[model samples]
Target: MVRAGLMRIARLRVTLAYGAMLLVVTSALATLDPLARERIVEKASTNLHNLAHGHFGTLLGSAFVVDAGAIAVWLPNLLCLLALAELLWGSTRLVVAFMVGHVGATLLVAAGLIAAVKEGWTSTDITRATDVGVSYGAMAVLGAMTAALPRRWQALWIGWWIGVGAAVVATGGDFTDAGHGLALVLGALVATRFGAPEPWTRWRLGMLAVASWFGFAMVVSTTAALVPATSCGLLCALVGGLASRLSALRTRPTPSATDMVPDFERHALS
Candidate 1:
């Protein structure tokens, strides 16, 4: 019994390992004075300047580091999400999907930021903006999970995320949002290797309209950090609701063809 219990726990070794690492990093951060901690976080950021200087450590370190005060929120949320991804994709696939989203999204966002700076669409100071956390990859994994959702839900979920991310960029919301959108795309793309969910239903045309408009509102309202932190915490809470719905439905038997018809479509026909 003991061995069996331990074996089951070991299945989530990746999530556990990550959570442990975060605690260690947070403890060390807490030891420092406020100013010093802030400075260290700034230095540890994988911002454009740090990347330009080729300080690879910052790139790796940023993913594990979070402000001491924020860990309470960060720890639980990430552990839940990461564990879900690990369970679905296995340890190796989860890690690969995450790192790819993190690194790829960071680079893509940075490139876009550089162009914006050059074009004078934004400030140079934005380049020095603090960029850290597991969200980029987390969002990717979240995006990748679209495959597990119902057919119509798969369309709306992915569409809403992409719309929000794109609106953030188009409206100059934040570099973070740009990265988020890209990570979602990257994750979804990679997940296609595992076989995609059913394609979008014709009803998706209506869902696209609903998702795009509301997704814009979700982005503009929070516009700060649409991930799972700081200003984006509200957005994260909404995503939390979505996740709960996803969990409830993940194991549900496929809906009948008639049952799958969206309410709006049925109402329209009526």
Candidate 2:
């Protein structure tokens, strides 16, 4: 019981920290140099435009366009979602899983963006109407939570994401369906692994870590130069999906007690 309380407190702290970081970043972006802010907005706008045109490459490229700028704006929302998950799954393992899943989705989007650019499938006149920060991450969070939810409730959440995506498209807004899709896939994969927590097999985890790092590196390396943004995002999504599947495969016989006991305790204790 004491251990559980400590875990809860820790999760709250982490969530708060994430929130603070987000607030700071938001303020900085709003008040920083005009040129920097303009660049950020431009990149964000370009991202949205690419998303609308099915230029997934550019959307992912947009993530890396502002260095830590995008992440600063994005990670807090993702962390908040994970905080909710922590309430159910406990702080340590669930947080790690959430982080991994979120990072995996980001990388996947980047890969897809790069791949699209390489293929010359994207248009040159990319505009900036589609840059909404962190919506994809939020969607991914909801998707991951839904995937981990009981089978009966899963469909509703899945439908919700689909509906949201459709609405974005219908309204002619800049929505990165590709990023949302990739994030969902990553979340599902992470949820599956977490749902059935297996033994900590070094080889499987190592492989996933390596793949994720490689995808991240690719995004970083290509950010400055002229590379195919859409193509890279696609690649990230592919690699992330494959890695998640591999991790899921290794984590057989899901960990029921870990997920259930915490919730049960909270309810019972309260």
Candidate 3:
């Protein structure tokens, strides 16, 4: 799995790296004027109202544009997670999973938000929210990558994602969080058809670490009187460390059976 991820990174170095480079440049340009930047973000946003008008350019373009603060964070996530999915499921299938998650979650969340607006649950207009970022795609890739990992790693990886995501949303529920949660679920569902997980060979220390962190976060969220921000930060740190350690582990690359069709004629001839 590690070698395969590395190979995918090599294959995507030019595409994703240059794309990240361009995002940095665009982000700098957007920062020059506060109003202009706001307008750009607004237009690039995939809004509930905007979707009704058949505006899909935002779906693809938003992936390329992000706030200056988030550009630093998302660039690495996009490269690492997407590359891993690309290697495991092939670039075409990975792209499909990403788009499926992106569009599906966006539409689903938009519908929910529109319903909220109609029901007067939120005074904030759904049409004006700055909902622009690569988060949807990133979550999708992470979800799909979970299916490609060994079961031990899969449980931990997927668990941390769900736990942290649910904790954050439970504390600060928002449209973006809803979109992220939906994307993860959608990605996992679609990816099952494209790839299978590796068998578990032993106890998964990673799973324990993730479960402990998740339990801590849940306990903090419910039992403690700590500020939400502080608790979330500590939880994020724990999960981030676990993810980094997982990234650094060396795992033997196994061939994906589902990704390749068997050659019956060649086998017969042999």
- Model 2 over residues 21-128: C-alpha lDDT tens digits? 566656767677878877665655434344556655544434333334455444543454546655555556454554554455555655555566668865534333
* Residues 102-189 of candidate 1: C-alpha lDDT, one tens digit per residue: 8889889888888998999988898789988777877777777776566556655665565556546655557777777788789888
Candidate lDDT scores, in order, read 0.71, 0.50, 0.64
- Please give the distance, in angstroms, between residue 191's alpha carbon in candidate 3 and its true position after superposition: 0.9
* TM per prediction: 0.70, 0.49, 0.65
With a 3 Å backbone cut-off (N, CA, C), the pairs that clash in candidate 3 are none
Pairs of residues at least 3 apart in sequence or in different chains that clash in candidate 1: none
RMSD of 1: 11.2
Q: After superposition, how far is residue 264 of candidate 2 from its true place, in Å?
A: 38
Q: State how far residue 123 of model 1 sits from its true place (Å).
A: 2.1
Q: 2 or 3: which has the higher TM-score?
A: 3
Q: What is candidate 2's TM-score against the reference?
A: 0.49
Q: Which 10 consecutive residues of model 2 have the lowest summed lDDT? A: 217-226
Deviation in Å, model 3, residue 203 alpha carbon: 21
